[model samples]
Target: MFSYTGGVVLFAAVLHASWNAMLHGNRDRFLSMTWMSIAIGVVSACVVLYLPLPPKAAWPYIVASGLVHIVYNVSLVRSYRRGDLAQAYPIARGSSPMLVTLGAAIFAHEAIGPLHALGIALISGGIMALALQGGRVSRAGALAALTTGVTIAIYTVIDGIGVRLSDGEALTYTAWMFMFYWLMPVIFVAKRGAPALWSPLTETPMAVGSSLAGGLVSIAAYGIVIWAMQAGAMGAVSALRETSVVFAALIGRVFLQEPVSAKRWLACVVVAAGAVCLGL
Candidate 1:
């Protein structure tokens, strides 16, 4: 329905899935994610210099969203460690819209319509299919993926509300949040020191470049999302962005050489369908 914003967010979805594939494929997930965050923060620092600060109303939500994002990263790394990208990626992304739906109904006392129910059903079915795959998804991985979904839902709500409160300064809010989130990673790098952080820079220059590229892609992906949320309904925008689940499954199969079964592919499609339903 939202053609212009839809095209932008679908592009974001592809970029999101691509970077996530890189994260899942990396041997040192935590370090790679941290490096990506550092790169994003560095770039954001420069970007934010020219843009005016987001209005005061958005600051608290920005900080809260940043903190929750840290939790999302930690859970995501753990999920990848414990499961296949095909399994973990779908589970993580698929559950987000459902949770966002449920949270609104429960916490915000919003009534669930037929479309929301249908979307939840589809997402739950997809997740169930993923979980039912014998020896594919670990218990810890499922839990971690669910945790990641929770964080996504929380931050989606926060950002949706926060950006609207920014008085049309969505880019400003996004830059500030990206910069603020890396504060933890900065401390992590400090404690680990230069040798640890710079080791990949010298040993594997390509990995360094990949992480940097992923960071830029990540910034662009989420920046679009933040901006799109300002123009669209929060739930729909979040759901549309989560179409990444399908792209991730394909990337996991092709790029990572992971053995993706037909059923798994179907499940991913179902999850994406659910997300689309939520958007519609």
Candidate 2:
């Protein structure tokens, strides 16, 4: 079950990195994010209207997931601004699966065997290696990225339970979850006032297209991962999907002109190997 789901999640990871690279390629990060959020909002709203409401019990998790997603968006945008996509992307994504593993062990009583622990350690080390550039590591950037990872893990676990509680309405839960997730960007734009927000929109079509792509990818990646968790282990599903870090590294090297040292490549290999182990 996990092997099949992991394959789909791997494709999701590729899409995930592709859209992020698209966002990073844009000049106006804020505008790109705004457009992406709007696209996500529109799609999610359409899906929500067509689907049934989630069960009452799923509401709390869905709401909490939305709030966490807001934090993730804010942190991700900030992190991207602070450093190279190669640096930020790996750190932010690589840290989450381990946290999810820990959370599952403690909260859900999911047991982690010795091999899984080693796999988690390798993934963490690889992420760290990728984040460090020229022997200079940004502790703040790492923390911010880790915070994003933690929040993702929180929602992963929440949604894992949510899908089960939704009486098998995974689609309904996901649609509404994204609908609520879009609210944070709207609130952020409102808080920033109109001028600061609208300036980015007028800038370029590349920016708009990038944001739309990002929004669509976000919807697809997460929706598939959530569904995978419904059909497999939450921890394994999160870990396997995050192998997108490897893809992110490749995108960074080729497109962003970020340095990918031999050591970092080795780390990427280790992370990929760990993911394969977890899938097995």
lDDT per residue, candidate 1, 140-246, as tens digits?
A: 88899888888989988888778888999988999998886576576557768767787888888787778878888998999999999786655666667777767
Q: What value does the lDDT take at residue 60 in candidate 2?
A: 91
lDDT of 1: 0.79
List the candidates' TM-scores in order: 0.90, 0.92
Q: Candidate 1 — number of clashing residue pairs?
A: 0
How close to the true structure is residue 174 of candidate 2, measured as C-alpha lDDT?
A: 89
| RMSD after Cα superposition, model 1 | 2.3
Which residue pairs of candidate 2 clash? none
Give the alpha carbon lDDT tens digit for every residue of 1-280 in model 2: 2466768988988988888887777776666777788888899989888888899998998988878887777777777886788877877877787778778778677777777676667777677677775655577777777777777788888888777788888889888888876675676668687666666656665667678878898899888887877767677777777778889889988998978888888889888877767755
TM-score of 2: 0.92
Q: Give the C-alpha miss distance for residue 23 in model 2, angstroms.
A: 2.3
lDDT of 1 at 171: 87
